[model samples]
Structure formats: C-alpha cells, structure tokens
Target: MNAPFGARGTALVLPQPYLLFLGDTTEPGFAKTAFGLRDWAGDKCVGEFALPGATVTTHLARMTPAQAYAEGARGLVIGVANPGGMIPPAWRKSLVEALEAGLDIVSGMHVRLGDIPELAEAAALLGRRLIDIRVPPAEIPVANGRKRSGKRLLTVGTDCALGKKYTALGLARAFRQRGVDADFRATGQTGIMIAGGGMPMDAVVSDFEAGAAELLSPDAAPDHWDVIEGQGSLMHPAFAAVSLGLLHGSQPDVFVVCHEPGRTEMLGTAGYKLTSVEEVVELTILLGRRTNKAIRCGGFSYNTSALGAEAAIALMARESDRLGLPVADPMRGGAAFDALVASCLA
Candidate 1:
C-alpha cells in the first residue's frame, strides 16, 4: 500500500511541484505515469515537458526544464513506460537539462537511473537525486498468514492497466469522506509515485511477493480500511504468480472486480481472450478463501473513460443487475458510486 502524496518515506522523498516528462511517447497507455500523476496527485505537479514529436499530453502547462525549475519544481519525473521500460537515448538530453536546471530525476522505468551514463553523470555532477520507484526493499519478511485486524478491500483486475489503482484511490477517498479511516495501498510503480510509498509487487522475488504485500498493508484499527491497488490479473497467463501472491498476502475481507468494458482480449498478449467478470469473481473467491474464509466481492469497477457518459452508466447498471452487485465508474461519482461505497461498508 502507499501513503498520501508528498508523504515522507525514509527511503525516498519525492519533492513536490514536479515537472512530468512525457518524452517521445505517443501512446496514452505508455504515458500512464504522467496521467496517473495528473489524475491523482495534480497538486504536486507543476507542468509537463515532452519531446517535439510526442502527441500524448497530461494537459498540464507545457514547460522547458529550466522553466519548470524556475517555477519551483524540484524534480522531473520520467512519465512514460515503453515496452522494455528502458530509457531511450533520445530522452537523455532533456533529463540532463533538468538536472542542470537543479531538478532531481525520478523514474518508474525498469532500468535504474544510475545505470545510464548521461543521467548518472549529470545527477552526480549536479548533486541531484535519481529516484527509482520500482525497486523493492532489501528485506521483506515471509508472510506468516496470520489474520490481521483491519478491514481491507482489494481491487482485482480483469486485465493489466484497467482500473485497479483508480478504483482503490476513489474508494479510499469515499470511505474517508464518510468518516471512515482509510488508506490507499498501492502495489505498482505508478501507484507508488502517486501515493508516495509502496512495495513493487512485481519487482519482489517470487518467494517474497506475499511478504511484501503483507508489509504493504499492516494491521490497523478494526474499523479502518486499506483500499489496496492490485497488480496483474489472476487469469493473466504471464503474470498470475504476482497476482496470486498478492491475493494470498492481502487476504482481503472484500474485493471489487476492475475491468475495462469492450476489451475482448488481454493486453500485451496475442490470442488470449479476456476472462469473464463472473470467472474473475468466482476464481478470486475460490483462491482468496485460503487466507480469509469470509473473503467476498464487494462490487465491480469499470474503466468507463473511453465510453460516453450515458452509455457508461447504462453498462454499469446492466452488469450490476446481472451480477447482483453494486457497479460504478468511481471517476463518475454519483448515486451509483455512492451505492458502491455503501455496499463495501455493508
């Protein structure tokens, strides 16, 4: 799980009023790092910078490295993730400029910033920090499987890059709005960037994945809720191990299925059809029962960002009726999402 934006974690402290670098990215999905920051932690971001050919935008004011630094931005976050998670040589010039302008470099890419000669030398010469969000802690204790005191609601994905993090963030905010103490427990680098601190579930050793998750959401007051961001899909052929380990460690009292409507196939995979919501709910319950016998699905969260307002609402209604569970696009807060919050509390 993660902390509130700007929250201090001993390992890394990302300075606020940041500049988001979109680099040469043209794909929206690849620019998730920027979108996530803009959507969830807008207050911490000051502006955006991108290479000339880039079409993607976070809609923040466009700025140069010096301009952003002059505007009080303390860091320049690499806000894109390509297939290999590697820093393109084309992006290094802007990174070095940001360092020369007195902004630290922050990244969620798989490649460590220190490994890149240009970024490493620039940061070292300029006394700037290179923060990598994907790195897990040096030691993660093995999960004991003992039940914890706090209540938890995990968002399980039907596929990767759906709505798990957004759902948890919205749910956690809703819970606190209703006077319940809650925290958004993040599990990915993007979630970690938005929430400040989290264990990268996919980065942890397989043997310690469950342990990392356990450390993520610790025991808390009985009434408190840890709205956890989920990792890969349990039905995802290549990434199910991390998902299963997270499920076992989270031992959620409740979960919400997060899906993107109209997607017929798994992302980043060929010929693998998407799993049904019913299948996800059933399987999650079946596997999750190993940890919490009372584990149950609270609702469904749809990524309706690509759908029209009325159409999105109608789709959720039909699905909710079919599944006999509350369904919503938490981003479209209304009676529907309120009902979802109610169901989780119930």
Candidate 2:
C-alpha cells in the first residue's frame, strides 16, 4: 500500500483478507462489533490475537510478522483498544514487518504511528504517512435549495469502542422497521472503510445520512433522520470536534448514545494510558451539550452484562429525562430501540 494521505483517491490491491487486531479483552468485549464486522464481511477471516494482560511487550517480541500477512489479504486493520503497555520500538518493528510484506495498515483507537519516535522510520516505510481521521463540525448544504423541516430529527453517538456503527445501524434499521424512508451513512472511519472497499455512491450517500453527514453540515439530510457516530473522546488529540458538530448541525430529533462498559480502564498498545468509560461519558456530556441536539436514547456495547445493561440504561434514562429526552432499554432488542426513536418524533 502506497500512502499519500487524504480521503481523495485511494487504491488497494486486496493483498489478503482484512486482518483485524482485536486488542486486549478489556476493549468492550469485542463481541457485538466483531460479530457485526464478521457478518458484514460474510466470513470468519478476522485474526484474533490476545494482547498480554498488562502490556504488548511479550506479544511484540515473539513475532514472525511475515507469518500473519496473507498474499490475498486486502489490507490490515489494527484495533489498539488499549495502548498503555505498548513498547514503541518493538511494536514499530512488528509494523515494519507487516509493511514489508505489502500490507496496507489501518489503525484505530490510540495507535498513532507518527506520535512515536522509534516508529518514525517505520511510519515512513509504507508511503511515510499514517491514516489520521480529523473531521471537524460544519454545516451540510441542502439539495436544490430546499429548506429543512423543523419537527422531526434524529442523531446518534458511541459510548464504547466504535459502537457508533451499531448505533447508526440500529437507527437506520429502526427507521426501516417503522417503514420510514430513511438511509444510513457514516463520515469518519466507517465511510472511508466502505468507500475504500468499493461501496456504490448511493449506498455511501445513504450511509452518510444515517450517521456521517451531520459533522460537516447542519442540513446534510434535513429531509431524512440522519444517525451518525462520534469518533472517540474530546481528549483524544486526533479526534475532531466536527464529528459531534454534525449532530448539532443536523438538529437531530434524538441522539442515540452507544458505549461499552468494559473499556473504562483498558490497557492499550505501547504502554499508553486510555480514559475510562465514566471519564469518556463526562467528555461526551460536555460535547453533547455543545450543540442544541438532544440525546433520545443510550445504547451499550453488546458485551454489557445483564445487570450492567440494566443499570446503564437506567442511568442514561435518568440523564435523558433530566434533559427531557428518552433512553433505550437494550432488553427489548433492536426493535425496542427503534420504537423509542419513533416515540421521540411523536
């Protein structure tokens, strides 16, 4: 993969099936997101490796990186749910091995290649550029100069990991369940993932309406209830204010919050510390209130325990009610989530 950064023009030779690094078990259990991606790909080709209980040092040392690379693999997606224990030099060497094998690297969480000193040369090895997602909040232009209707609105966010995809998907799914002619799309990561994988224009546009367009334009899809996901935390340097700005700009009828309780204190790659769920929620509340958009429901990671789910749903509900919004009860499944959305519009 030759990297000249920008979402403009990207090409992949499909070197092998996508290789996903699941990171440590503390990253929200990985059940729902993994299952979703697995189903989306229609194959169980994702490679799951266990990170050391406290650090990635041991894992990086015993590497035959070439062994992980598949000649047919399309690219590699490294999920650094935790970076606390990561050894920069060791991790950098492993990444270099993967690049030498001709693998296009896609990183998530706090795996910023450019941030580490040892990895500078390695970062340069694969076109000398890392994929940095930095979308800021802006207003979307309406098509044909049509003004937006004030009443019905929709919004969504991620509570844990990249659960924003699920939140966005659930909203779109809920809209369809209600027979509402709505479409789905995501701006940041998911959009790039789809477009890079060769998704069609209509689908991409629809996906954006579902979740991505809200960041840039307030009226990205005024006629349709758009459900978009937030990248990570405000504290995250690479994370942009634009993601949340999109939801505010759209003036969503309701905002759906998705999160994983397990990620509160996850140990990440390269010994970098990550914020907890409680901390993240605090940041989220600050950002959520930044725009006039109101949160309608809160969705938890699939791995949330029954009791944990109940408590989270209740806490979110109380918060929402305080804000005059509604919270979704996960026990009712996706349909229940959808019903809550429809009620919000009512």
**Most lDDT-accurate candidate:** 1
Model 1 spans with C-alpha error above 4 angstroms: 1-13, 24-29, 51-55
Candidate 2: where are CA atoms >4 Å away? 1-17, 22-45, 49-72, 83-87, 109-111, 115-129, 134-166, 176-225, 230-244, 253-327, 330-335, 344-346
* Count of clashing residue pairs in every prediction: 3, 48
lDDT of 1 at 183: 89
lDDT of 2 by residue, 209-295 (tens): 323333222343345554443444444433334444344444444545454544543223343345543454455555555444343
What TM-score, over all chains together, does every model reach? 0.89, 0.49
| lDDT of each candidate versus the true structure | 0.88, 0.42
